[model samples]
Target chain A: MSKKPVKGEYIETDTGNKVSRRSQIIGTTNIILGGKTVIQAEVIIRGDLLRTYTSSNPGEKQGNPVAVAIGRYCFFSRGCELRPPGKLYKGQFSHYPLKIADHVFIGPGSIIEAALIGSHVNIGANCVVGKFAIIKDYVRILDGTVVPPNMVIPSFSIVAGRPGRVVGEIAEGEVDGMDLREVYREVRN
Target chain B: MSNKRQSMMPPAPKPPTSLSSSIVIAEHASLTGTKLIMIGSNTVIHPRAKLNSAYAPITIGSTCIISERSQIGILKEPEDEEEAEPVVIENGVVVEVGAIVEARRVGEGSVIEVNARIGKGAVLGKHCKIGPLCEVAEGEVLPDFTVIFGNGMRRIDNSGVEDLKMKMVARQVEVLRKLIPSNIAKFQ
Candidate 1:
């Protein structure tokens, strides 16, 4: 008889992050997960691609060493991937950190290589948010949308299509539904 | 091409019927119901690729590459059908990273790219290219040399340039064989 993988299989971190053992997370040391986040099975967070370039800004060291910084109450569904964006700057290859703000929900099979994703963003299934794209607060990306590289998405907007465009606006009252507390509670075995 | 004939060496070698001894399956791969799966010689299944043949038998031909997070025969066969036929993938196919192929037939030298989905009962012909992030709808039939690309666009690519692609895939398979540890006995 084949044994079924047990449901509600999650490890509760000291910071309240519920991570699945089946998730393939490389370079865990380079990832910073805030409290109450959920990383589901088959989710890959690639932290091995670290920044090789020194800080070009004033008063900074060569290697600060952070690849992925995810905020509170974020839910990464099964088969999704979070990859840090990399580029050649000054003829040197380097990867930048993927910064995700609070209350974000990424659906299954989606690939995120965005530089910045603001709070309360809900990206639907199989969407691909491209490299260095900046997304502001309260954004909802419809299922199967592909957000092109370096694109900017404004707040309170709903985006869809291939190379995603603004399709609609989110009502002010709908903001509360974006809270991930209920979703977090339901994920428990 | 020599590997193709060797894989067809008759059903007499039938004691260990399903899983082939010549295939390289990663130790971490989840192979549920191995009795329902048949992998030809020189196939390299990357670590973490899920091949669940519990519902339907899956037959993958020689020198195929199943990449990480890619799956074959994993999804439950569509419920409405009275009986779902087994999936058949012919020789020299490359199923790339994160692809989900539940097709009825994947022909020779086909390349299923990253994050692509081949829906249930789809038939992809010889040297077909299913581009990254694309989706072939369920039961769709694609002829040989068909190239499906960005945003559901498709066209026939009959330039006959599979030699370079096969060489690159072979090199990738060589690297993967060294990178991922194999445990063929675990499923056998």
Candidate 2:
């Protein structure tokens, strides 16, 4: 029997990130991906919506100008989008950075416009995380959930519904399953 | 030699659509169909937004923000006997991510939230708000200040804060103009 060599589907970067060739990542200069991350095909990461407002403190360091920052062992599934949240503040409109911590997994076709997502978070398919929504650590957002704008989700919560609300809690033992380290390894390409 | 030189210079191609100089259209935004698409000044069209004018023309007013994956245009042509009306979006309208707008007229300062669908020929009055994932049936007419929200609930917003909201939309357009680099020449 002849063995066929399967072609890899992802482009592995030097920093141990596996990014698909078909991903539509805009404004690449403003995006920071930590090592061991996997970005699947057709995923759109909008890093162009950077903060336009400047602080008054001239002496303070400008620091990093990143618009979308994702930490280690994260996974973005096919057709998902990551967009920084923007709002009108004090009569000025500015986009805030989307910060995602380690071991996060976002499912297919989900549109995330959250300001912050903590570690070990798993967002299911076709979900919409609204503007400035803060999802804390070890949370599971079920499929098709539409989290309202400015919602703050606590840790270890299971959120579901149109205007998403915490329907249940994630047990301590189940928290281990939320980690995306194993899922990252499984995407060999 | 003079004839050869004249032959080498190709004629300039005519632009298919009309766009104001101050509008910001991203490089990846799709503008399809044979009919004319007229976009006014200070409008920001995000990447991957689809504007199809195959069945009828589309007129988008000033200071509008059309977000990513949102589709604008009529779903189909009108019946053989009737004429297809153009899709009209007035000033300060906001169509959020992944929304489908096939409205005959989306009134001034209206907002269509993410993933919502405004069906064919719907006439929305000024300052209407359609919430996320909501569906407005085809040819439906919504009054001014109508807010369609959770579980298809309807309400009228009489807070008299429309001026403030319109100001916010204008500010958002200003910020987006700087953030989204426009390649209007490519579309032309």
The global C-alpha lDDT for each of the candidates, from Candidate 1 onward, is 0.83, 0.92
Among all windows of 10 consecutive residues in model 1 chain B, the one with the lowest summed lDDT is: B8-17
**Stretches of candidate 2 above 4 Å error?**
A1-8, B1-15, B77-83
i-RMS values of the candidates, in order? Answer: 6.4, 1.0
Which pairs of residues collide in candidate 2?
none
Winning model by TM-score: 2
TM-score of each: 0.61, 0.92
lDDT by residue for model 1 (A1-189), tens: 548665557989999999997788876889999999999998988775566567668777555578899999999999899978766566544678999999999999898989999999999999988779999999999998888779999999999997589999999999999999999988885
Interface RMSD of 1: 6.4
lDDT (Cα, tens digit) per residue for candidate 1, span B94-185: 88668899899999999887688998889999999987689999899999999987788889997877876676566555544543467988
TM-score of 1: 0.61
